[model samples]
Target chain A: MSGHSTYEPKTGFERWLDTRLPIIRFMNDTALDFPTPKNLNYWWTFGGILALMLGIQIVTGIVLAMHYVPHVDYAFNSVERIRRDVNYGWLIQFMHANGASMFFLAVYVHIFRNLYYGSYKAPREVLWILGCVIYLLMIITAFMGYVLPWGQMSFHGAVVITNLIGALPVVGKSITTWLWGGFAVDDPTLNRFFSLHYLMPFVIAGVVILHIWALHVPGNNNPKGVDVKSKADTVPFHPYYTVKDGFAICVFLLMYATFVFYMPDVLGDAINYVKANPLVTPQHIVPEWYLLPFYAILRAVPNKLMGVILMFAAIAVLFILPWLDTSKVRSMRYRPTARLYLGIFFLACLVLGFCGANPPDQPILGHEPSGFMLLDADINSIVWLSRIGALYYFAYFLLVMPILGLTETPLPVPEGISEPVLSHPAAAPTGAAAAPEKRG
Target chain B: MSKMLRKGLALAALGLALIGGQAMAASEADEPRAPSGGWNFDGPFGKFDMAQLQRGYKVYREVCSACHAMDLMYFRNLGQKGGPFYDPKYPNPNDNPYVKSLAKDIQVKDIDNDTGDPVQRPATPADKFPAPFPNEPAARASNGGALPPDLSVISKAREGGPSYIYSLVGLGFNAPVPAGLTVPAGKYFNPYFVGDVSSAWHGKGPAPKGGFISMPPPLAPGKVTFDDKTPSTVQQQAKDVAAFLAWAAEPKQEERKAFGLGAMIYLFLLTVIVYFSYRRIWRNVSH
Candidate 1:
């Protein structure tokens, strides 16, 4: 059955086109002949789920764009109409909104999985870098989409962010004006944001294709640190992985359906219901949850330009992680000391994200102010937490892996495929004869 | 193999616990009740007794409906208690039949045509109160540069919200006279007024100051009687209308509160199940 030829080219033109494109052959080879490690487990499935979410977002976004009006006066009302009057418009809007949160949720898992398994090491560096690019594009797309509603949060957010650009030295004001297409964030700004928000998702879809292409070259990393050395150590991607990935996707969809149908606004902001008003401001400003950690870093620094640059650099730093960590082992399983520290580093990142979402606390009383000193005991607890987390974030790549590579002792290595005790246990003799060496 | 499964189970358990904790934290903060003057609503807050709301509903049904619209609120909402409309369940019920009879004349648009124009008919239970003008230009032309805004969602749209509405309604008392502006005993100046402020007639407006408000104080003491002996002051009426407007803006208030409660419970149970499932699935595995 596997060897049978299913296709027959009737015409010379069709055969010629097939040779040039080779689309079906490419899919079969990468998705079939690709040798995936047997011990990948569930965590590795998140990359495929993230890709599915990206597709969901692009399709829903295009449909929404067809009905959404971009003018400031009409944008708010248009959303209301979509909610109340259009055919199943509420479901579409809710899916697009919540799908964004889910996409981020999956990507976070994907990144953490990479970190735990050292998927960024060696030849897989390009895959990790492309993933970072996709992450950046996702951020831009979500931010632009947030402003298209022209609600109170959208209007104020646009103002706050556009003003940040004006903090630049020479042509700052002009740049902001050009961005707004006016003196302030008004009708023109909303229109342009609508256009770009509609455009960026498709751009992200393109980047995701590149991300998958990069992943295919090195294939996937698995739970075991050992590389595939024999047939038993690997499996073809066709029946095995195709079935596994398909099952994972179904389970993910069930979880997604719960949010889409039951609690659509679970991740939405309340203030967004109010139409745009230039004179008013929301009591607090926050970006979406996926942006929280970087936003925390941006707020951690006192200086505006420094904060902006540091926040960006924090993300860009991930691209260079392959070169930064000098460890020879590919997975944390082989590096016991580094594994514990990396787990703590991951926890710190989660904590930073939570802090960023909540309101920043005031500094405790009776403490001296510290100036630009990286470590200051007198600063607010939140500031300290952010600072420490930021330090660990850099240290994980800059110090821990390299130091462990030289000093730490690894566990006993497993022998070749057929030699492990469990794989090749000596058979017991018949009941009485099996006890021959018991006295010794 | 068992060790890998155990690690995966542990991670899933942790994620579920975190989600459950967040849901519990959020539901505690989302309880719904009457607004009790916090944030922007503090200081010299006006009263909005049931009787006053009844009167405001009267004024809305009668005088305002002549030229203004409230396309956001439903007629059935009038039956709800503690809102701008008189609650039928109030201890001393006002003459609702009289009010309802008067409101019967008002025509509201019930459906939209293929061209997206509202098809007008007598107001129904589910229909939002109709606007006085067909569109923005028509509203502006009729109201002398005062384009009456749609009252639907107005309470949520403004910064100070109901307070702003109340304050704006009661503006123009003890207002200072501008240079070249004429002084009248009862007229109020509106900033949005088309004519020059210098030549405009100044009067005792609803509150203290007025720049360009067009409409005069429509609610005077004794204009409408309250069954509960509450004073029918304009301030009281303003408060009632503001409260009513808040409800109009978020008609799903009750549903939101209920859903929040259910979600909290569901998350808690799911968390517990996930914890045990993790234990069960990983019992034989070493991490």
Candidate 2:
């Protein structure tokens, strides 16, 4: 989000280097002269927080890989050696492991912020897709990275996810076998996962560059969803957002550090501590908390193939979000009808996450509640309740969005980014409270 | 009235789903509780007690070491910083009297230097703890289809950690079987451990399933003598060994916490400066 670059090379070396590679000019344009929205709120800071997390993961991951051995027999012990024998190794492992969770947490906030402000509309579509692509890469990278520890959960989780691929028709078995490189989740799987786990971060960094480039092209979509009318709506990214984002990043790091130092195992599964055994599976097979919503979607459908498709389609739907949201108005601040449904959609996702974390065998409604059918399908036990959650999740995008856009009356919007803030001095305690400040 | 009805219906639906999910969640909360006490290292600020670690090592050597192998440990580790036998006089553990004597007691498999032939000799301080079993099959064969897991990271590897270990080795043995629960012919009762008790799985009553462990309760009232005049009771031994294992799991715990404190202090200061800087920069901007 910037005006034309006003950066001019001053020094001889800078001038010479600018002509050769324009690297200085590029950095100046993106970091210094870039015009971010002046009215951007605290939610806007997560984008910067995510970038910081990515850097932390990469640095700590490299150090961890130096000491980590990938052999199945030795993998668990090697990790122990890092924690015990290597100097400052426990800190590095905690940083890398907890770093992944922090990265996901910030990215989730970033995405929800986009959804709230309709940041994916029209001109910002490619930027949004590139972001979605980055999210996809992160999921893959984190999944592979989890397997390198060779814990029971790590091994079984890999087997379960790869086995999901086997749900595909015809050539699924061969593909699954090829993925595992043996009849079961074996030594070679761990080896390949470690290599890809190391490599995927660089790939993510490449896509992240593209994501930022696409973002800078359109400038930021403010909470008002109003385009910048004049230079008054914008400020240079360096002094304003740099300080703001930097502050948010430090706070975020502090929170992450608390978990790493005080209670590292709180977010992790205790079952994963045990070494992987092919003969035994954990009593409760669950994925990491971040993957719970998708896992719920996968289990919601009883059929294997359909479950896999729906889980993927849940993410794929994001690519078409701009179109799916048929509203002429961008911000949900004005669209009361959409906001109502969005609340339900948000709650549904949380419920899905809850369903995912718990075992499906637990009987719902205090007793065994079964045979609740929808669309000729039997909804059995607590798993069926997840279907209710998944239904709203899909419907929020496919049905409620398109229909609400056509029917709902939106509250009046501010004429510009500064309108609400300038209009009320004492009355407006927060920018969000004075939102939808309609013109008289 | 219609608008209010619609809103109420939405709220009801949301409430029902959430409550239903929580009910199911409550029923599945069956993780066995483990006892945790009497350790030098228990919290973020806690550190290992050197005397306890030494006693724990003695217990491990005399009793547990007969069956389990600590594959990741070197004899020299005994004299490393944060370990039981670490004496500052011996910068090299191989030269330390305690470590050297322990290493010399074991015969290590190696290659002859001059003849390039396979040979065996007394181990040096640098050597890893030798396995009691030659291979996986042999280990399983000796232990009735279950291989004794390596002790290197067992503290960190299990669900309840050292607390679970203490409970399993101390309170787990000789406990009366719960009502309606029968111990099958080659199995033993151990409430702290959840193992391959297919018997309980089939004949399930009030007794929880899969609560049997093999290896036949390795610790007793006075299995290993303590050097520092501490009681050699099973409970004391269990607590000591648990403390030692916690150190094994994360020896750098204290260092990590120390670094985190410094980093947190720096970050707090930086946040303060940046917060002020943000306000100053935004002062001129109208929006």
Strongest candidate by lDDT: 2
Strongest candidate by DockQ: 2
How well is each residue in B1-287 modelled by candidate 1, as lDDT tens digits? 12332232123221122222222121111112223453232222223444545655665565556676766455655654334554455422233453354346667655576677657666544456766777878987876666665666676655456656665553323234455566454446543222233334344432222344556655555665555666767666556666556555644333333544564466556555554554554454332
The digit string of per-residue lDDT tens for model 1 on A237-342 reads 6556655665666667656766765555557676777678786566556677888888667655545566567777888888898887666566666557778988
**What does candidate 2 score in Cα RMSD to the true structure?**
6.8
Tens-digit lDDT string for candidate 2 (A1-440): 45566889999999899889988888999988898778888999998898888898999999999999999989987887888778788888888888889999999999989988889987889999999999999999999998888888898788788888887899989999999999888998999999999999999999999999999999889888877777788888998899989889888978998899877877888777788887776656678888999988887665678878999999999989988877767788877778778889889989999988865534556555454543432355546678899999999989987877777666666667767734645334344332222321
For candidate 2, the per-residue lDDT at A121 reads 86
Position A360, candidate 2: lDDT:
50
| Residue A411 Cα positional deviation in candidate 1, in Å, after optimal superposition | 3.2
RMSD of each: 14.6, 6.8
